[model samples]
Target: MRAPRDKVIITCAVTGNLTTPDQTPYLPITPQQIADSCLGAADAGAAVVHIHVRDPATGRPSMALEYYQEVVERIRAKNPELILNITTGPGGRFVPSADDPKVAAAGTTLMVPEKRVEHVTALKPDICTLDLNTMNSGKEVVINTPGNVRRMAKVIAEAGVKPEIELFDSGDIALMNDLLKDGTLKGPILCSFVMGVRYGFQPAPETVIYARNLLPPDAEFTAIGIGRAAFSSVAQSYLAGGHVRVGLEDGVYISRGKLAASNAEMVTKARRLVEDLGGEIASFAEARRIVGLAPYSATRAA
Candidate 1:
């Protein structure tokens, strides 16, 4: 068994690429709301806030740099201590056309690898996600080819930001190990296991244990559950010597027949759960040290 961590880090994925406003009225769409939600999650004991921006008017996921700048500025103005983890998860989904399998369908967001991390390069956050999955999602496939991932990693490295490797299956873990071996990604890595997605790593204790065992000795991981598994994975991940994550992006409901009123509500529950489990929540500074992030002032000046 991996040694248990003294302090648990709760990461709140305030908004994600796939989650829509229609799924939950409480989902933050505007820059102001996203920033406000992030700040609230921080106040409720989340040391890190995972972010994705959406179009203000239509509530569609956007890769616009302007929106990211606005949200980051707003959050930093309020609480610079909260670690910001921006998403590079957009612009990777592929929906093939019915007539021409090679051609992309209307929902396809696939773009050049460089285009995907444009915001991360320009508005460098403390950490940015680097997805390593090429998996089937319903009828569509999310593609993150190895070569493209390296190209994105190069840009992320140049920006001096930490890459939070998001693993969806056992293969992604294998790929991460390879990346480490080949020096594509540096060690003392930070990663997350995204559970409960259809055809991805299912939410289970064994799955968490299995994935956790595959990671490098120094890797810091969080196991995130989607839909019904969200809260349960908080305890599952913690017990398995990993961190936890929760937000509307992973699930809309906090409990059966009830929606989480805000991301802060979800973080509050996660905090209570961890404390109940005899684990103390990591403060922002402690989490930064654990994740190898520079202090807030140092990051800003970079």
Candidate 2:
């Protein structure tokens, strides 16, 4: 039998919470913008779009089901085969008390585990992320304790949604592994190494190597290297037997000292990297097959 082609799945995270228009003018916020960004990424060779919705009016993070519905509807209207990976990760940010260390003031958005997965259950996305670590994420602390991870895992498993176990460092892989052994995570595993964010995993070949080594063999892994570590880490990830993630969510720049005009540009660059290294890009159907995600027959576009 002839050997199958090595296919690299390109995932584009459309919009994020932390970045603002002041930082980058092209970051998508509204449903139309997010959907457009996904379409652009698809045309640029991306097989998946990982989404986090924002308030259409203020551009702040939103958990409203309608917002997610709009984004999904718009994307599916164009292509039902494109994979949609929603984020259940926004509600976990904890910016501890600025004045007193004892009392947590505002700036935190921690929710009960069930509350966090509400959108996942309602949206029934192809895949969704369940961040598995509690880390000092910049000025804020992003938390996902054992109890919450277990709770959310059950909810995701019951909803028949693939949880993309998001980790920031090597220890996180071990922690997620522990959950599997404990029977908390009960479906096919997908991992994404979020690198270069301050106070998170530093982006480098060695760090990626260690992190990748810690993942379960049954796991399918990808990388998102933010800020200055973007392209270099993606290159390293492909070199290390993994896929790459790109978009306004990960980095605002197309190159050092230059800004990216859109998420499509990011996907285009990622495609170039995979091809230059002799790896083929996965189509939407192929990506679903590789990631073990069942297609959502619930498409409104259908």
Candidate 3:
């Protein structure tokens, strides 16, 4: 088992692809709202903010480059020091048609892997998620085939942005090792165990330990709990030598009954959890150094 970290990195996923305004009225739908939530999370204690934009009018998940550009620009204008980890996870889901299982249904978003990372290529955020799972997510399937993952990785690498491998299960971790071995991905990698997704990795203390053991010795990781496991995973992850993540993207409830007022509120609870466990939250510079990323100014020059 890995030893505990000296400084734990708290990453706040301000908004996600699947969460909707109906789930919580506080969900950040517009670009301005998303940017404001991110800055608030950073101030609350998150070193890194994982972003996903949505349609302003419909509040549906959007892969529009302009939306992403606006969010990144707004975040940079206010807090260049805060790490930006954008999502390239929206366009990989496949919904098979009942009439023809081989054909895609209305919700299918599978597209050229290059199209998925277009914003990452353009904005060149400090980090972007590279989902490595091809699993059954509820009624739909999230497909990140090995070949497509390589294609996406190539675009992310070309952009000079670090890809935080999002591992949904143990198999994804194995695939990550293979990618690292083949040079499809670089070493000292950053990854996260996305627990509590149905049919994927379940959240538990032992689950965290098992996934942690499978990672490369030098790899950095975070164990993120989705839904009810959200806050619990923060303590579990830190005690097991990994970092922590929490936000609206992962879950909405701050306590047993109440919904979180904002993304910053979630981060506040996560910070207290880590501190209660005797872990120190990593600062902006500390997190950059830990993840092997350059400072904001240096990244801008590239």
Candidate 4:
């Protein structure tokens, strides 16, 4: 794919599935809080808001369709133009039992493919994530087997929502290629190259460039650097001709040893980087055109 020369799309991942409130007090838990944060990020120049709902009381990641619906409704009510990208990648975790090995241990969140994409089918957002590979995302394994990925891809396609093919390492690009060739996925494809996750791909300039080279001709990609590598990855992604993502979901700190005050703060920093590097930030309408999403009104009606 050709590099986006004139505009950069900044995506803010409002709240992720793994991080708890204890880790960062600023994490948005309630649906209202998540919606507010998304509005704040958009105001601060984020073209898209990537959402993952959580249980308000405990701050645990939730797959409840109601939570997803409420969050989307709230965000849309406030800022109808901002692109919404919800996640379907949260319920695939697998932690093996210590004794049996085959049995799922406590904290395992593995679900059937249908259940994983339930929210996407119910609430048709502008975009949804489709993690392309299964790998260890810490102590637990995120099981996205090829069979399940194919199933989920079909479902998401049927729903008319664009899939952001998420990749943790260069090897996962093979699966992306397979999906593209098999007609399970279509162009212009959207991919997220997630870096610095433990046991996944490392966050580095070479790693980012390597993944960029592996993308298909019609694909548009974003690079997200988790934790300390977040800002660095943002800079590198822009330099490597891809878009950028930043928020509490990927990292808590705005800089060395400083926790980001909010998702908007991180986005503000990302916007600065994009502008300083001679690239203009894409507005919501521009992002919609770049990603090939339907109009906001049509999306809501769908």
Candidate 5:
């Protein structure tokens, strides 16, 4: 394992496209709620806030540009320093129809590469996710072909937003290397190992370590364990020289059978865990530098 850094970056995934309000009342739905969640997470020691917007009335995931614009504007107005990582992984889902394999089934959101990255280009966030692999995400197939990935990577890079390559399993690492070799992605890459989603890598120390070993030496990575493995993955990633991400997007529960009150609560606990391990939490500016982002300036829009 590589040597652990003295400082760790904590990212809070404020809201996700998957989970709904029914599963947990604490999930942020409206733009105001999402913005507020980001602020709370930042206050709780999270340097970066990963966001996914939802329909305020229906509480369903939305790719509407206005929703994103409003959310980003609100967060920027209140906390300009926090790094925002918007999701470009939402429209890649494809559930093929059993009756007609050529056609998409319900719950499929397959989109053109240009449309998938429209928000990133428009908003110019500090960072935007670039999912490097296509695999089964529960019942639906999350489609990210090599061509699509390259296209999205190019667009994101041209927009001046750092791409956080997201990997669900070890196989995804090969794709990451390909992107690096092709120059679609640059060095000191920021990767996130998302574990324990259905059909994805199971959350375990060995799994986390194996994935970490595949990364480029100069790359910085974070690990997130879904549901029950959330906290354990955080500890393992920290011990193995990686950063951490947590929030309602990954898991709603703070503990077994108990739902987290908010994103802030999860971040607070992450801070304590890092501290208990004798690690210092990285500030927003420090996190930007560590991830190869330019220093934040007040004149810069969030």
Candidate 6:
């Protein structure tokens, strides 16, 4: 039961890893307000934005490499082919010393696996997020081991860059199948199964169909849900066949506890639930050829 409009890859996530502006005033800090909310979430129906930067005067969360080279050169200076995904899960969160709970707490937590992805290997962003195994990221306890996801997937596959692999529970999808059988992840393996984050993994429909049956038949995936389970897992990840992520970086309300003014109105309400489930939304160069990405470079990206 996983095959509808065929290619549905939305993936917005314009700014996250921490919501500020006192938890939701449309949280997109500087670098031109995250490149103007990632160019209005890639013209509503985002084909892949997923960035994270902040610190426009203390909004916080910033591992500054010139604010990720000016928000990936202002979203490739206006969609020069925008499939930019950048976030090495912002270092790694690890709060400890609550009455000496084994000391280690200075706010911007753990940054080691090559300084937790040195600004995605110096802005080689066509995709970057190697947070393959680290749990309990609510208010501490996140440790991406497997020797830091095999040293940040071997420097994001020697700077060719592409490691989405962010499975949060069901054992991090067997640590991304042991980083794809230790060849250190390469192939079409892009994953994201972020359920609610209090303890991680809890958005149901059987946890998005057991994280799409622990994908390992040449995996390619996406599914984000938090805060009212993002309208039941973005229509349950398009009824479990995969692909779909939304904005305000994992929802900042759009009902019940309402408050979602923009982030291109959360990808225009996730492209009206993927055209009311008849699904058809993968643009930005067909989501860079359905996420193999390697083409959009408007004049060497400005």
Give the distance in Å from residue 244's predicted Cα in candidate 3 to where it truly belongs.
0.5
**Every model: Cα RMSD to truth:** 1.2, 2.7, 1.2, 1.5, 1.0, 18.8
- Residue 74 in model 6: shift from native, Å? 4.9
Candidate 3 backbone collisions, by pair: none
Q: Model 5, stretches more than 4 Å misplaced?
A: none
Give the per-residue lDDT digits (tens) of candidate 6, residues 1-302: 46654668787787786666776887888989888888887887777888888878987777788987988887776676778888887667778877886788766377678877877778888888777656666567778788777877888888888888888888888877877877888766888888888887888878888777878755778778977888678888887778888887687887777788778887888788878888888777777877687666656666
TM-score of each: 0.98, 0.94, 0.98, 0.97, 0.98, 0.31
Residue range with the least summed lDDT across 10 consecutive positions in model 6:
131-140
CA shift of 118, model 6, Å: 21
Candidate 2 segments exceeding 4 Å error = 1-5, 98-102, 295-301
Q: Order of all candidates by lDDT, from best down to worst? A: 3, 1, 5, 4, 2, 6
- How many pairs of residues collide in model 5? 0
- How does residue 83 of candidate 3 score in lDDT? 95
Which residue pairs show backbone clashes in model 4? Answer: none
Assess the local accuracy of residue 180 in candidate 4 as a C-alpha lDDT between 0 and 100: 84
**Whole-model alpha-carbon lDDT for candidate 3:** 0.94
Candidate 4 lDDT over residue span 72-158, tens digit each: 998887788999999998778889999998999999888889889989999888899999768876677888888999999999999
How well does candidate 4 score on lDDT at residue 128? Answer: 96
Per-residue C-alpha lDDT of model 1 across residues 1-302, encoded as one tens digit per residue: 87668999999999887788778899999999999999999999999999999999999989999999999999888898899999999989999999999999999999999999999888889999999999999889999999999999999999999999999999999999999999999999999999999999999999999999999888899999999999999999999899989998999998899999999999999999989989999999999999999866745643
lDDT (tens digit, per residue) of candidate 2 on 1-302: 11223999999987877778788888898999999999999999999999988998998888888899999989888878889899898778787686886666688888788998888898788899988878887677888888878888899889878889999877788888888888888645789999887877888888777887787766778877988788897788888888889888888999888999999999998889889889899988789889886644654335
Q: For model 5, what is the C-alpha lDDT against the true structure?
A: 0.91
Candidate 3 at 223: error in angstroms? Answer: 0.3
RMSD (CA, angstroms), candidate 1: 1.2
- lDDT, candidate 1, equals 0.93
Query: Considering only N, C-alpha and C atoms within 3 Å, which residue pairs clash in candidate 5?
Result: none
